[model samples]
Structures are given as structure tokens and as C-alpha cells.
Target: MADTASQLMLGSGLTVVSHPLMYVKMLVQVGHEPLPPTLGRNLFGRQVYQLPGLFAYAKHIISIDGKMGLFKGLTPRLCAGAVGTVVHGKVLQCYQNQNQLEELGSDQKENSSSLDHVIKETTQEMVARSAATLITHPFHVITLRCMVQFIGRETKYNGVFGSIVTIYKEEGVLGFFAGLIPRLLGDIISLWICNTVAYFINTYALENGAVSEMKSYSQAVTGFLASMLTYPFVLVSNLMAVNNCGLAGGSLPYAPAYTSWTDCWRQLSLEGNTTRGNSLFFRKVPAGKSYVYAQKRFY
Candidate 1:
């Protein structure tokens, strides 16, 4: 119980700090269009069209909005994250208890192998994350919408309560769960990949004393790699959720309905030239220096 409590508090704090990075990444990726005016043309006055490069655009955001601008949608994101952490813990516990009960009743329990335990734990994690995603999904939509709105865009949704009320009024209850399927899919893949890789590292890479000391490092690496691998799915989910911010009282059109994950991927891939559409899954440079440069450029 103490460990879980500590984990929850730590997770919430880390998420609060980290959420803005995600917000900025999503905003830039989705807002890629009519290149920033400064970069739209070269010295010759001919249109030197280019897809928004990650670093240049990030610099632009910092320049125009100042430091605080990066954290535009933080409140709702923190709310969802804090509550989501609790929900994840409780749901995981419930599933674990159910699994224990099943093991007690079944004769196979006495003969259960390591592989069986691994599979059971993985299943519990999947269900817990899926349930948590569904419950907290509305907050995610609101956060994304809030983050994407810029100086010229509509700010129909104000704070958390205002956003919820507006979304309910404008788009109905279903609007709250706009990108649920893709989000859930991404969550599941991320959880599985991270857990499996971490477990493998824990088992194979560390000995008794070293294991305790290096556990955090191993887990961090696992998470980074997992996120990178599953980010494309997350990008698609974000597009589905935020493009449909129109449903939540914004100007962007609702993303076209996707009949299946493959269909969605196919459509998103074909819509823009390969580099522009697929750039969301990768980053060319860090934003810190860009933010400083941006501040200097605009302020």
C-alpha cells in the first residue's frame, strides 16, 4: 500500500511536468500548414514552401507565446493524469484479485508455469489500462483541443469545467470519447512493450545488488523505447481526437470516420506527402534550445 501510494504521487508529479512536452509536440505536428510566414519564402520572394520543421516551428511557438505558452492545456491534463493514476491502480488491483480467485479455484494453479504467470499479468495490465483510458479519455480530448488553439483560433472551451460543459452541449456524450479506439490501442501496445522489455531487462541484465540500483534506469529506457515504437498510433489517435475538436466547438473539421485501424492508417498516410504525414512519429531536435532562441527572436 505504501509503495503504491508513493508510486501514485511520483507518477502524478512526473506526468504534470512531462505533459506540456506532449502538448507542444501534438500541437506542432497537427498545426503543420502554410509554413510559418518567415519561412514561407526565401530572399528571392518566390514561395519556398516547406513542411514545418520541428525545431523551427518549436522556436516560433516560444517566440510568439513566451515560456508559459508551452503549458497551455496543463490543468485538464494534470486532472486526467492524477485521476487516471488512481483508476489504473484500483483497476489493476481488481483484476489481480480476480486472477487470484480464479487461481485458487482452478486445479491448474498448482501446476501454473512462469509463462502462465507472465500471460496473466500481461492480461491484467491490458484490461486495467483499457478501463483507465475509457474513464479518463474525455479529459484527454479536452486537453488536446485546448493545447491546439492558438492566438487566432477560437477559445470556446475555457477551463476544465467549461470545456466539459461545452463539449457536452455541442457534441453530445459521444464527443467525450472521440478517439477512444485508437487511444486504447496505443495504450495497450505501449503497456505491453514497456512491461515486456522492462521485465526482460530486469531478468537478464542485472544481478542481485545491481538489480536494485539499476532498476529505475532500466525502466526509463524501456519506457522511452516503447513510446518511440508506439508513437505513430498515438499520433493517429491525437488527430482523430483533436481534428474533431470542431465537435467540441472549434474550427477544425471532425476527422473522417475510420472503420478500422488499418483504414485509418491508410487514409492518414495517403493524405499528405510521406515526409509531412509521417513526421509525427519522429523528432529531429530537442526543444529546449529552440525555446530560448524563440524567446530571443520574438521578445
Candidate 2:
């Protein structure tokens, strides 16, 4: 209980600090670029058209909605974080207890290899993560819609309960789970990739002495790589959450009404944008593609 409380407090603080970047990233993910690209030198010193970086994009938001605007949707995000942390802790504890009982009753516990133990732990964590995600996804949907409201200047999803009522009226219960499938797939795939790659590197590539020492950092390194690989799913999921949800940001010119998450993926792939919004800084427009600035706000 104490650990869970600590995690919730820490997570809330981090969420508050990171909400601005996330707000800009969500706009970028939904293909809403109100600002035009500027001439800038790339890492190699070659001139290129650079989209607004994090600070620049954030400044634009501030210009429109003031400093507090950067925190749009933060309340629901905090709620989601709290709920997810508690759910993950409870579910993981339950799984570990059940595993302990089974191990005490079996001979396999004495014979299980380190790799087997690692795999078992990873599996348990993945299950806990999936459960947390499933239970807290409604909060996620609310958070995304609340953030996207900046584009249309709409105030439909103001507070948590108000947002819930609005979603039920506009989209029914299914509204709470608009982008769930792709989000779940992304998380599960990323976990497996991270764990598998980390295991292989630690077991086969490193010396036994170094393997023990590197074990702590291997998962972090591999997790970054795994997130890069599965980022398209995340982009698709965010877009799906707001798409056709009666918001201008989800409509044509900003975004097309994706038939499904797969359709969103397909469209993004064709446009060479499966990894859009992956970077908060140093964004470069693809060659031959130029952004046309919107002359006025949607609402």
C-alpha cells in the first residue's frame, strides 16, 4: 500500500510536468500542424525545412490558450495514471501469490533456470500491464479528446464526469474504448520484443560476469528500441481515439475518419507517416511534402 501510494504521487508529478510535451505530440499525431515549417540546418549542417520543435510548438499553444492551456486534459491523465498504477500493483500481487503457491507444490521451482524465472516474471508483468490498460482506457479516451479539443476550440469534454456523460451521449459505451485494440497490441508487442532481445543479449553476447552487471540496464535499452519498432501502433491508437468523434481535428484536412485502426495504419503507411510525432524535437518534413497553414481556427 505504501509503495502504491508513492508510485501514484510520483506518477502524478511526472504527468504534470510532461503534459505539455504530450499535448503537442497528440496534435502532431492527429496531423494538426497549424504552424508552417521553417528553414533550418539539419544535424549534418545541410539546410532543411524543419517543423516546430517542442518549445516552438508549445509556444504556439500558449499563444492561443495561455500558459495553462499546456495542461489541457491533465486531470483525466492523472486519474488514469493513478488507476493504472493501483490496478497493476493489485493484479501483479495476485499473480505472484498464485505463482508462489504453485511453486511450493511443485518440484519445478528447484530446477527452473534463471532465464525461465525471468520469462515467468516478464509474463506476469505483461498480464498485469494489459489488465491495467484495459481498465483505465476510458480515462485515456477522455484525455485524448480533451486535448484534441484545442484544435476546434471546443469545450465538450471539460471535466471527468462531464466528459463521461458527453461520451456516452455522443458515442455510447463503445466511446470509452475507441482506440483500445491498437494500444493493447503495441504494449504487448513492445514488452515481448524488449524482454526477448534483452534476454538474448544478456545470455549469448555478454560474458557471464558482465551479464549480471548489465542486467539492470539491458531492459531499458531494449525497451527504447522496442518502442521505436511499435510506435506506429501508438500513433494509430491516438488518432483512432479522436477520429470522427465530432471534433474538427478528426475530420478531413486534419484527419480522415479511419474505418478501423488497421485502416488508420494503412493510410499513415501510404503517407510515409507511420512514425509521425515520434520525436518532440528536430522534426523534419519529408521531401516534396510542404505544410499548408490553416488560415483560421475550426471553431
Q: What TM-score goes with each of the models?
A: 0.70, 0.94
lDDT of 1 by residue, 1-299 (tens): 78677876887788777765675566655643323223355445554433355555556677877778777888888778777788889998887788789879988754332545666677888887787788889999888888777634567768999999998998799888877887788788887887777777877778867877887898799888887777768877776676545532223332455555466568767754112234532332222335344334323
List runs of model 2 lying over 4 Å from the truth.
107-113, 290-299
Runs of candidate 1 exceeding 4 Å displacement: 1-5, 33-59, 98-113, 193-225, 247-264, 271-299
lDDT of 2 by residue, 174-253 (tens): 99999999999999999999988898898898898998789879979999999999999999999999999998888887
RMSD of each: 7.6, 2.3
Tell me which residue pairs clash in candidate 2. Answer: none
Identify the leading candidate in terms of lDDT.
2
Each prediction's number of clashing residue pairs: 0, 0
Alpha carbon RMSD to native, model 2: 2.3
Model 1: weakest 10-residue lDDT segment is: 280-289
Candidate 2 lands at a TM-score of: 0.94
